[model samples]
Target chain A: MDFLELDAVTKEYPNRSGPPARVMDQVSLSVRQGEFMAVLGPSGCGKSTLLQMAAGLLPVSDGTVRIAGRRIIAPPPEAVYVFQQYTRSLLPWRNVRDNVGFAIEHRLGRRRAREVAEAQLDQVGLEGFGDHFPWQLSGGMQQRVAIARALAAEPAMLLMDEPFSAVDALTRLDLQALILEIWARRRLTVLLVTHDVDEAITLADRIAVLTRRPARMAEMVEVGLPRPRDAVATREAPQFLALRRRLLDRLLLRHDG
Target chain B: MTAERLLRPLPGLCVLALILGGLEAAVDAGLIRRALLPPPSAIAPVLWDMLASGAVLPPLLATLRLVFAGFFIGSAIGVAAGLAMGWFPPVFRLLEPVVELLRPIPKAALVPALMLFLGIGETMKITSVALAVLFPVLVNTLQGVRGVDRVMLDAARTHGWGRAHTLLHLVLPAALPFILAGMRISLGLALVLAVLAEMLAGQGGLGFLILDMQRSFLVRQMYAWLVILAVLGLALNALFLLVERRALHWQPALRP
Candidate 1:
């Protein structure tokens, strides 16, 4: 059995006046342990909704989602979501340490939780910044705090929804590298949703392209690139360029069609 | 440190002081009869005497006790009910019509009927104040709970926070500012109703003291009690603002 499985999953949202609309049309996918998968699609492609459903934030309208053979009927603490908006993700009222500590404290005892949270903060290169509030930190630093919070939970899976889209170009590259390092060190199974093709190309071991609204998987591409990849070298590789061109052509053709 | 900040409140305070001084001068000069509008100086001595004799302490305490009791009880009920209504649409639909029916009827107007059932005592006064305090708190709390961001709710749910945990941790914390604001308004209304109930249906409190002085033709005494009442109201409002400031220190303060 796959570590995480979505078997013929469908999701529908009801409107008060109109007919119920299907957002996911019998979609299915499987994620193995320690796999880094990125889902790339255009805006309003219901990719985020799919992530929400997989994380158990929304119930499947039909079919089933299973994590390690257990069906996901409601949110399970085993998997955590890293939201797109870093500013709104962390509770403003809580300082960085407390925000990270909150998840640990809820999951474990207070003293052990604080220890774990402090350690996770250090791991994220935010050791002394724990006492500072989210607003006091720069956008990149805030997203780091959010990442630390997710890591503190020791979740089996990390569901990211364009977590770097809100930051500057310089910061986005830095964060992408940071995520790669963390994923390698922790051996975390990551499922990231992004619109940036470069981001998908740089980080993902496998990329799943999603179609427009009422999203369905269009294509799945495997990155044959080796581990510990350099950003500059990977972008310069002939294989990388060829893959990017092919994906762009596919996206444009779909758009025109 | 800021020049604009230093200048902002100066003109308003100066104008208020000037108007008050002018009113005192006009009354002292007999442009307005002392019987109708006694000068501040005349009322000051009467207030000193009342305070010295401890004549005002008991009633002030009575009013304070009633206001606090009513405020806590009303706020508790309102917040719980509001959360229920906000989280569950069926509960909102079931309770909304009844609340709307009771809300518009002036809570003060029920004083007579309450007095008839509960008598012209502390019970009637507390009930009146509680009733008056309930609506603003209920409405504000409901609005606050409803206004919580959908994304936050989703975040909480995705984190495996159950319904009770979400209410205690996410919903209550997110809605705190609105709940506090509503309670502040309700506190003022609670005081108003307490005084009104005492004046119309009872024989004690600042309101009754004023009525007593008026009956005895002690206009200065009446004015003195009125000043004390104003001071008390101002002090209570300041206390509430202070508590609100402490509780919501995370929020940036707005300049007026």
Candidate 2:
């Protein structure tokens, strides 16, 4: 069995004054144990809605989501989400360590959770930021702290929703590298939803292209790239450029149609 | 130093000093009659007399006690009810109309009705202040809880936080700023109702002291009590601001 699975998942949002809109239509996918899959689509394409359904944040109108052969009714502690707005994600009342430690303490006991949170902070290269509040940190640093919070839970699956879209391009590159390093080290099954094609190409093991509103899986392209990939090397490679061209062609063609 | 830090409070202090100095000068020069506007010198001596004899201390203590008790009780009920109403659509729809109906009725006007049931005692006085203070805190709390970002909520749920856990961990922390703002407004209202209750019930408080002095034609003493009330109000406001700053220090500074 696959590490994670989504079977014919459909989500429809009710409209009071109009016909109920179907956001996701018979969406289905699967993730292997160490696979990093990126779902790429235009805005309002229900890529986020798909991610939410997988995380069990939203109920599937008609389908099933399973993790390790077990059907998911709701979000379990083993699967965690990293949100896009890192600044608002962390509670303003809590310091960095406590925000990370909150889930740990709730899941584990106090003493054990604190140790795990500290270790996760270290893993994210945010060891000294434990005492600082979210507002005191820079945008990139805040996102790292949020990543640390999710990592502390030691979840098997990590779901990211446009996690670096709010940061500057330079910071986004740095964070992407950081995430890649972490994913390599932890071997986490990751499903990232992003509008940035370059980001999807750079990070994902396989890219799932999605259609616009009432979204369906359009295509899936495997990225056969070596580990510890450099940005310059990957972009310059003939195969990488070919894949990028192909994805862009698919996207622009969809737009024109 | 920041420009705002230096300039923000300057005009307010200047206006307050100018008003007090002008009032004192007018009274001293007989431009305003002594009975109508007692000079600072006269009022100072009367205030000193009351403080030295400890004539005002007991009632002042009693009034403080009542204010705090009412504030705690009313705030506890308001926060709990507001959270429930804000979280559940059915509960909100049911309670909103009743809350709106009762909110506008003058709190001071309810004093006579309360006195008939509880009599002119501590309960009546505290109840009056509590009723007056409850609405702002309740409304603000409800709004605050409702105003939490839907994105943040989804993030929490996706992280496997249950409904009850989300309320305590996410909703409460996010809603705290608005709740504190409401509490600050309620604190001032609490003080107002406490004084008003004393004045109307003919009981002993700073309000009663002012009334008694006026009846006896002790105009200077009445002015002195008024000064004390103003100071008390200022002190309470300052305390609320201090708490607010400490609690919300983690929020990033935003340009207005």
Candidate 3:
């Protein structure tokens, strides 16, 4: 049985003065326990809509999204979605630690929540930013704070929607490495949606390429890179280069068509 | 930047001083009618006497009590009602007509009716002030609540936070800047209504005192009451600003 499942999901957005537009059609995917799966597609291809359904942030027009044998009708307690727009996601009214702690605050109480937030902030290499507000931090650091916030809930799965697309190239690489390190450490079921082929190749166990809207799975490419891989070494490897080239050719060919 | 910051308010303060100085000079030089606009120097002595004789305390206390009571009462009702209406469409639909109908009727127009029902007493005075404060707070709150970022609400939902929890922890905090702004506007309106209530139908208040002093040809005492009224308004607004600064310290400073 898959740890996370999306079975024949479809989404239709009703227009006030026009026919309802179907954004995505009959999408199905499954992720095993402790696997990193990346959904790669061009921008505006319903990648975010798919992730939103799995996280129960948006309702599916048809079919079920399930995690751990349970259908997700509402946002499940055991999974958290890390949004790509970190600036919008993190509360400006809260300092870094408080924003991270906000999710679990009610359950743990303030003191313990602060402690949990501190621990997560440390994990994200933001040990001294507990007092700093979101506006005070750089974009990359703010995203790290968001990642820490997602971790604070101690979710079994992380649904990430192009989490690094907004950052600079070097920061994106660094964040990709961070995600890999965290997944390695925690053995989490991670479903990442992105447009970057190299990011999927570098971090994902398998990459699911989605076609343009109405999006559907075009191909599922398995990554054969070795585990505990160094970022520079992995990218330089023959297998990595070959996979990257193949995915790029496929994506570019689709774009041209 | 540091020098610019220090110099920013200097021009405004200097202008204010010059205006006051000019008014005093005009009165001293007998260039302007003193009855219409009393010199700042003469008014200070009369205000001191009123304070020393302790005749000012009762009216000051009366005005403060009414203003504070009305402000708090109106704010409580406005915030709760606004939030409820904003979050739920049904609540808004049910109550929106009543709000729309009542909101536009000049609050002063309602005073005679309120006076007839409640009598010329504290209840009437408080209710008048409360009515004046209510609309602005409610409107601002609704705007604030509706303006909450969609993403923040989604974030809360994903955490399994219920409606009540979300309202308190997420919605209220997001709506705070709007709420405070509304409250500040209501503060000024509240003071106006308080004084107006006294003027219209009052047994005793600062408004009554000012009128009585003027009628008796005690010009300096009348001017003194005006000064007190101005100072009171300034003090309340300053206090409200302090509260706003403390509450919204988390938000980054916005440039005008």
Question: Which candidate gets the maximum lDDT versus the true structure?
Answer: 3
Candidate 2 lDDT over B113-210, as tens digits, reads 99999998898998998998888889999999989998778767766677788888789889998998899999999998899888888568888888
lDDT of 3 by residue, B1-256 (tens): 9999999999999998899899999988999889877898888888899899998899999999999999999998889989999998999999999999998887878889999999999999999999988988999999999999988888888777789888988899999999999999999999988988998897788988888888898888888998899999999999999889888987767511
Per-model fnat list: 0.44, 0.62, 0.73
Over A1-67, each residue of candidate 1 has an lDDT whose tens digit, in order, gives: 3677878888889978898898878778888889888998887888888888889888899989988
lDDT by residue for model 1 over B121-160, one digit each (tens)? 8888888898888888898889999998887777676666
Query: TM-score for all predictions?
Result: 0.93, 0.93, 0.94
* DockQ (model 3, Cα): 0.73
What is the lDDT for B238 in model 1? 97
DockQ of each: 0.55, 0.58, 0.73
CA error at residue A178 for candidate 1, angstroms = 1.8
lDDT of 3 at A234: 86
Query: What DockQ does model 2 achieve?
Result: 0.58
In terms of lDDT, model 3 sits at 0.90
Whole-model lDDT, model 1: 0.85
Off by over 4 Å in 1: A15-19, A109-111, A231-233, B2-8, B28-30, B51-55, B88-90, B252-256
lDDT of 2: 0.85
Residue ranges of candidate 3 with Cα displaced over 4 Å: B1-10, B17-41, B254-256
